[model samples]
Structures are given as C-alpha cells and as structure tokens.
Target: MHVQNKKRFYLMVGLLIVVILLVGFSIYMIWSDISSSNAPVQTASNTTNTANADSSQGNRTDITASQAITNPTDLLVLVNKTTSLDENYQPSDLVWVDLPGVRETQLRKEAATALEDLFAAAELKNLSLYCCSGYRSYQTQEELYAENVKTYGQKEADLVSAKPGQSEHQTGLAMDVTAESVNFDLLESFGQTTEGEFIKNNAHLYGFIIRYPEDKTAITGYAYEPWHLRYVGKDVAAEIDKNNLTFEEYLKTS
Candidate 1:
C-alpha cells in the first residue's frame, strides 16, 4: 500500500539521521584527542613551576631530565628529580662520622674530612652546626617514601620526600646540618640564624654549597633546604656560590 510504504520511508530516514550524528560525533572526538596530544606538557611543581632558564637564548629552556650519571662516584655528580643514581650504586669510600646525635652518619672519606673542617670552622666562629643525616640507602629511602605517603597523600609525599634512587643522600656527598638556635631542628628558620649564615657564607670554603637555596626551588625541584650541603670540591663550590647558580645550572656549564 502507498501509505504503508510512506511510513517505512520516514522510519528509514530517521534511522539514517541518527547514524550520521553518531559518525560525526566519533570523528570529532578523535580529532579533539589528536590535537590535545600535540600540546606541550607543563611540569608543575608543588611550590612553583620548575624553571628552565637559558641565559644565552634569553628564553625558557626545554627542560628534561638529563641522562643518568655514568659514574656515580664523580665528586661533582648531579642528582635530582631528573637525574637519579642507580639503586645499587653505593659510594665505595664511605667512612663513619662521629657527629653529635646524627643518624646514618657515613659519608665519602673526602666529604667527611671536608665536613669536619666545616664543623671546626663553625665552632671557631662560636656557632654549633650539628650534622643530622647523611648517606641513605635505597631501601631506607623507599621506607621513608612509604611512611610519607601514609602520613600525607601521595601527591604531598612526593613534594616532601624523594623516591628511591632519587635522593642525594645516597651519594654520600650530601649532609643535613642543624644548629641549637633552631632547637637542633632542620627548620627554614635555621637559614636566618647566625649559625646558618656562617655556614651559608663559609661552606664553599670547605668544598660544600647549600644544595637548595631559598629562591631556587623552581630549579632545584624541592623546597629550600638550607641545611642540605653538597660537596663538589672547593673550586666548583666557590664557582657555584659566586655565580648564584643551582647545581642543575652548574652541571650544564661545568
């Protein structure tokens, strides 16, 4: 019948319209995803955006984690969120430290000697810098990270604690120092005290530099840890201090 055929024609047209709409939607979704994938990813840090400076070009550098250090024992080896030491790479020249109330008191022999000189120099200046921590193992760092994750959520814990193999303490060339002025605590307030000032000004003379400076969190990938000192030999330390450069910057030029 003509009327029956007319109804069937309308039904087919409606189904065809629905099919076209679904096909168009699928194409739009695929195109949107492809465009999004081409966009540059922003590396957001907890405190601020990690800056990638290129003074020569006077523009933001393309920041990326450099290749892992070939020799972890290199005196000036750089380690950070980007640069990581191997889990099995422990320093061969570690020596026990007898500093007061310090845990994990072992450092490379050369660094240990420099630390003693630094502490002695502080004492002569009537400032007491107490070494708190040094030389963490991969397992120890893993435990620390898990504990932090429990206390704070994973996002917060990532900001506060380094993941295993990502900590500089594993290198035996970094030390955390505190003073009685801050109740022997590793507090940012320590950086403002006379003792912290002495270390800040005098540490490079003893082959060490403040690993994280107050203004360098964007470059250092962590909050300012004024108590953390990394030994890179006095010449390199002095250069880093004089230029006001982060270890990341120093590595690029050095």
Candidate 2:
C-alpha cells in the first residue's frame, strides 16, 4: 500500500510540472506575438504615408536618398537631383495637352486633363496661362543641356538645366508655364506677377504645384523656378501648399 501511494504521488507531481511548463510556454508565445504586432507600420516601399488628418502628430520616418525609383508608373514618383530616371523611362500614356494654341507638348493623360481644367479656370478669372514646354525626352534634354552650356557657360547652365536623366520633364509630369505678363518667358520674376500670384494660390486646387519656390534652393539643389509646375494630384498638392513644404519635405514627413 505504501509503495502504491508513493507511486501515485510521483505521478501527480509529474502531471503538475507538465501543466506549469505548458502555461509558461503559452505566456511566452503570447508576449512574442504582441511585441511583433506593436512594431512600426511604416515602410520605405510606400515612400510616405498619406497625409492623414493628424499629419502633424505622427512619428514619420524621413525619406532617405534612394536609387532610381522602382515603379516609374506611380503617379507620385520622386524624381529630382538625387533620384534619376533611367534613360529609357517613358510615360506610356502620354497625351497632347489640350489647352488652346498652347505648345505642342504632351503630358501624362491624367495630368493633361487636370491641366486643361486649370487653364480653363484661369481664363474664367481673367488670367491667361500658357504652357511653354513639357515632356522632353532624354535625347532632347541632352541637346538642350548642350545648348544651355554654350549660351550660359557650364556653371550657370547646371543650375537651370537638368542633366539628361535627372529632369522632371523626363517624367512627363511637369510643365513650364508662362503668361504674357512675363512675355511668355520662364523667369523668376513671373512669380511676382498678378497672374503668377493667381497660379501660386490656385494651382493646388488643380493638382499642380509651383515645383521650386524661392529661398528653397538649398533643399532642391536648383535655383528658384516658379514657372515649373509638377502634378502630384490634388490632395498631395493641397497638403504641400498648406504646410509650406517642398515635395521632398512632404515625402519625409507625411
């Protein structure tokens, strides 16, 4: 009888040890899963998070300098001094800009439609906006850069003209706008004109932005070019305008 009791006690103790081990393992697994779930939700792939309502209140990761963009077809492609499009990158949906008697330039289909609306709205308010240039191919930009070098010398040219693959024009997402107020010339002075003021105030409503603003030369690595307009979609444009952020800054924060 004593031997049987001792045997039963040992069996009970073994079963209790097994239960305790099982519970401890389950707690450890649950803790591990919770830690993983609470990790960062940001990704380098999305480039920037959408400008949420609480845009001012988040732990936004800065957009680091990256190589060529992986997806050129994405509407919000970041092409600037640091990032270059490949020699062969081209918009598949290029369409002629439909503003009356404007330059024979083309923009991406969605951009073209938004540009037409922008122009029409400007006309309604007695402002005359002109499209001076758009969508320069890699070869065209190379030739233009050479011409600029001859006219302005290399140092001056580099400030205004982009090297072949580094131009926003290559993305088919930008246009050089002008007005008779500035004699259809792309000049920094244009930003001071009444027509320019209209554009600066309203371009965001139409999905356009004054790509390079004055005093932002340090960030953009280019001189101020108020004439250059880039399409980044209305919501993005509005957020950029509202926050007084360069697209680079916007990408970094939001």
CA lDDT, every prediction? 0.81, 0.82
User: What lDDT does candidate 2 reach at residue 99?
Assistant: 77
lDDT of 2 by residue, 36-134 (tens): 999988776554443342242212223232311545655566787778889988888899987753468999988889899999998999888899998
Clash number by candidate, in order: 0, 0
**TM-score to native of every candidate shown:** 0.72, 0.73
Over 4 Å off in model 2, which ranges?
1-68
Error of 2 at 26 (Å): 49
TM-score of 2: 0.73
lDDT of 1 by residue, 1-254 (tens): 45668878999999999999999999999999999999987666633432321112111122222422645766766688877888898987899987664454889998999999989888798777788989999999999999999999988777668999999999999999988789888888888999889988999999899998988877887888889999888887888899999888887775
